[model samples]
Target: MTPIVRDFRPDDAEAVAAVRRAALPFMVTTPEGIAFEVDQASPAARYRLLVAEEDGEVTGTARVGLAHQSPTPGQAFVNAYVHPGHRGRGAGSLIVTTAEAYLAGEGAAQVYSWVLDEPHFRTFAERRGYRPSRPAHFLRLDLSNGELPPLEEPPAGYELRAAADFADDPRPLFEAEAECTADEPSDIAAELDDYEDWLADTWSHPDLDRDLTMVAVADGKVVAFSAARTDGHTRYASGMTGTLRTHRGRGLARLVKNHSLHRARAAGCTEAFTGNDADNGPMLAVNKWFGYDICATEVRHVRELG
Candidate 1:
């Protein structure tokens, strides 16, 4: 078994997506999305998707890059995944080593990754000098058969609309996203205040389903939104769901999310996934009301740089 790591090619999309699905079923990945990332990765991220080939067969992958989107300099992330059947071999460790070298070359001082809660996975990271930090949970909802809260009309003067309605101008959506993200509970806070950068990264992302993303508007002002990302097949994921600080207790987040999930179900998505920090009590409560169950837990681990 000769396993070698190499940079990803356009043809590796399907195989890459397959490996990700088997290793982490919680996140939805598509061939197009994989390709798009490789083509559009920011220069600062130094993003490279590496595949581990065992005797000409792609078995594992590593998404290695700087957290360029993050305001913190020298912060990098390496998410490595090896297929179940391919585990126990050196594929996973090799990918990690390869990614770390690349990030180090790219000027990443401190590396971070989300190690699965499983004993072996956690042990692997700890042995590599990475200490655990914040923890996040991955949740799933069976939209096909599970019960979902019925969608309701927003209060008078407040209405629900699809994100596509703002096709002509999405600056308002960016404004809302920036505000909500700044308020999120996270170990590494994100500041996404630039619209052009947001356009290049978020709104124009391959998986963003504008028609399915629900937004709550009050008096023509975009106040709350639930962005939906889908695989165009059977899986749906809530990319982000948030409400502006001005309208927190108005049930707007619930309203937009419920509508987005319903639309996803109608569009043939059977499984839905969302994640949250353990400290985000408000979001955990919201997800529970929507009938989502905890599927997997990932404890965020961080390591200091020399």
Candidate 2:
């Protein structure tokens, strides 16, 4: 059966999530999360979730969008995934072809995607003119059976709090996140200055478990945070973990993450996952100390739109 690509419909949420789970088991994917992403995307982003169907079954999916928050204009991205059982078909090729044309029409001059660091995946991207860039690793921890570090007390003048504590106002968390994100190592430079968008897209995300997210406050200010996303069952993933520049080297990142992991485990979460850029040694070391093992690696690939 020939596969055809089309824009994702609301009813395709579950199928899309299933495809993602089959292609990347380390990360958490939920139907509600998929719907939320499509519904909450900013207009500037031109976000489009594309699905490849064969005999009325969703066999592949791709997330196509412009880097709206990037300072550099004309930067775009498309990450495509084909179900393991459906590979070797033309679904991946068709999805990328459709996404590239759409992005080019949207005035994008460059596009980036993440290809799994496997010979077949690398060959597929290379055949399509995508050149390898930086690489990242997906790490997993067995929250149910692994030994997590004991929670430590925050330093003298610092205290730990739940993200839910800021229910009335989450601006402090946003401030810390913006600061940390701007410093993160990435192929695309993002400027996270829109608080309203952040509130809608992140703070209110369906998967964000405020109760499990731990924050480190110093001098009554949010200095570090470990954001947690859960599947409401057994899977928990670290959305982001960062410390303010002023608080670096103080072990605050570790402190908050440890607390969040313990909370997740107590809440019945059996597994935890996170990703880190290969260039980010500090974060990799931190995850290593927490007993996380590298489960998979993906290399970023980019191509000129001309």
Candidate 3:
């Protein structure tokens, strides 16, 4: 079967979402979410949503882009997914070839990607000259029947609020994100310098569940938060949980996450999912405290683009 690769169309959202869901079940995805990503992606990143089709059916998809948020220059990322039934058909290779060509043209020195922790998949990345760096695990919690830890009253001078409560003004949340990002462990450091861009891509994403995203406020300032993303079905994920540098070590991160999980459970979410680098001991401890179990693992791989 001959496969043709082309830019994605708005109507192709379902096929693209299907590809992502089938290839990566641990992550939450939706058609509307796909459209939102392509629509709001910053131009600096040069984001491209590509799909590989055989005859008239979409079988593979790739999200290729530069890391615009990263302070490091010329860093690129490409995450591709192919339907399980369509393996060994050259679709994956074609998508990677297309992504690398684009990234290389943009003067990217290195490209980062995540490959599942499987023998056959690792062999493929090694064959393509990619080296493993950091490993991350995806955790899942069965929330349907399990008894969640009871929410506690906020400590003095601290109040718990939903992310939606700040709709009128989210600059405080942005400030918290900026501070927390400074501590995240990543090869490329990110700087969240623009609030307008965050509004478009992060705050306004189709799947972001603001009502379930818990925020910690101190003296009317957003000091910590646990963002939530839902599939509008039964699955929920911790988008990002961060505490301002000054607020760290106060248990605010864990506090907001617990509040968010309870909100999600009350909102009919049956399962919770989150991912963290194996080296992030603090977050790993927090997730373990929440009763989340590691369900899947992936290793970040890097390769120099020719």
For lDDT, the strongest prediction is: 2
Score residue 97 of candidate 3 by CA lDDT: 90
Compared with the true structure, the alpha-carbon lDDT of candidate 1 equals 0.90
Model 1: CA > 4 A from native = none
Clash numbers, per candidate: 0, 0, 0
**What Cα-based lDDT does every candidate model obtain?**
0.90, 0.97, 0.91
TM-score to true structure, per model: 0.97, 0.99, 0.98
Query: Worst ten-residue run, lDDT, model 2?
Result: 143-152
Candidate 1 vs candidate 2: the TM-score winner is: 2
Error of 1 at 253 (Å): 0.6
Candidate 3 residue spans exceeding 4 A from truth: none
Cα deviation of 212, candidate 3, in Å: 0.3
lDDT of 1 by residue, 1-66 (tens): 968999999999999999999999999999999999888777767899999999888999989888
Tens-digit lDDT track of model 3 for 1-306: 878889999999999999999999999899999999999999999999999999899999999999999988989998889999998899988999999999999989999999999997788888888999899999999899877777888788999999899999988888888888878888768999999999998999989998999999999899989999999989998899988877789998889999999888888999999999888999999999889999999999999977
Worst 10 residues of 3 by lDDT: 146-155
On TM-score, the candidate that comes out on top is 2
Candidate 2 vs candidate 3, lDDT winner: 2
